[model samples]
Target: MGRSFKIALAQIQPALGDLERNLSLHEKLCEEAIAEGADLLVFPELSLTGYFLKDLVPSVALTPESPALTPLKELSRRIAMTIGFIEEAPGHFFHNAALFLEGGEVRHLHRKVYLPTYGIFDEQRYLAEGDRVRAFETSFGRMAILLCEDMWHPSAAYIAAVDGAEFFLVPSASPGRGTPQKGIFANAKAWELINRAYAQLFTVYIIYANRIGYEDGACFWGGSEVIGPSGECLAKAEYLHDSLLLAVIDSSEIRRARTMNPMLRDEKLDLTLRELQKIQERRS
Candidate 1:
């Protein structure tokens, strides 16, 4: 019987470039989640500003000291929260970022490292990429955040796991594609496989909160989910709808999973480093 906490995933549809409306929705959802007895509430990527934010990035960019965040910060005094937005750094550079708030302050921030620029996505043209991936301390436990495409790269989660993160939060704005007859959406199966693999391999709890509804022509598939350390789906929200998904995670499960699997225990860091050096040298 180790630490256990209830987490809420708010799968929402955000208004494009409407900061005030999005902020209000976040406040409402935060209160709802708190009423549901959630220890933490997680929202989707670019939650404050809808996806397809090309020229709008500059207009919606928020500074760390922006007064607009005061209400959410106040809400954190009672329940922890994580939300995404466009961050305006020095020299006019912008980053897609997630903010973790607890005790009326921002405890940690993870900028989206991998920005998808292929097909319908054009993030590279409007945003700067984050350079680091690491976990930080929280009221719940050691936790880490990875936004959308960051979870697509195995290295991101690997780094978080190596950095001692026991809980992983992924906020996404993935569009629904392919035949719905196959599954919830075409990308749904892919996400399920990716998340379950990460959980099983690293023995970490995973919370995936994806946005729903359409932005311009793109449709975001809302299938927010929580996966256990052993790759079990604890809870999943319905597809193509605004939902509040909840799950209770026990820290002891990580211990049990690691003990049973021992993948992390038996990892060969030296070998991996050596191979990575070889690959870099070969590339050069």
Candidate 2:
């Protein structure tokens, strides 16, 4: 027996650029999750404004004090909540940010570091890149957030692990690709592998909430999932449909996994740092 809590992942479709409607949807989902006895609720990336925001990014960008998030902040007093949105920083800069709200306040904010610009993705054209990745303390424990493309880079997960994150929350709007003949969307499989690998490597619970439905011509596959510290899928939502996936995470598993596989304990941080410095110097 260990400290356990249930989390709900809202795998829903957001109307493109419909901020008011999206807020209402989030409110409804939060109420439903609360009724279901969820300790936390997670929404997909750009959930407030939808993905594929090109020039419209500025129109829906929100600051920490934005009135648009008032209701969500209020909801967080009862249960922890996280949602992704376009964050408006100083000087008109915008970022794909995941906001963690708990105890009626904004607890932590993670801006997307790697903005995919290849193929169907073109985030770099509209958003600024986040410079750092770190974990923060929460009521549940130390946690970290990685938005969409950030999870693709191993260094991002590594940074969070080094920062003592016990849980990883990833919000994504990844579009579906590849045929069924290839076995579940190739993109979805990649995400699953990434999530499972990180959970095993860092001995942390991984919660991935992805959006569903079509935006323009691109369809997002909504296979939101919860992976345990042992790299096992605890629960998964339906593909191509809006769903509320729930799972319970046992905090004790993290300790057990870490003890069983002493990778973290045996890591040579100083050597890795020195090597990285040498690489940087060589590049410079």
| lDDT (Cα, tens digit) per residue for candidate 1, span 58-150 | 999997679999999999998998999999988888999999999999999898999999977899999999999989999789999999999
* Local accuracy by lDDT, each model: 0.92, 0.92
Report the error of model 1 at residue 12, Å.
0.6
CA RMSD per model (angstroms):
1.0, 1.0
Cα-based lDDT at residue 268, candidate 1 = 86
Give the per-residue lDDT of model 2 (tens digit) for 139-173.
88889998888898988998888888989999999
TM-score, model 1 to reference: 0.98
Off by over 4 Å in 2: none
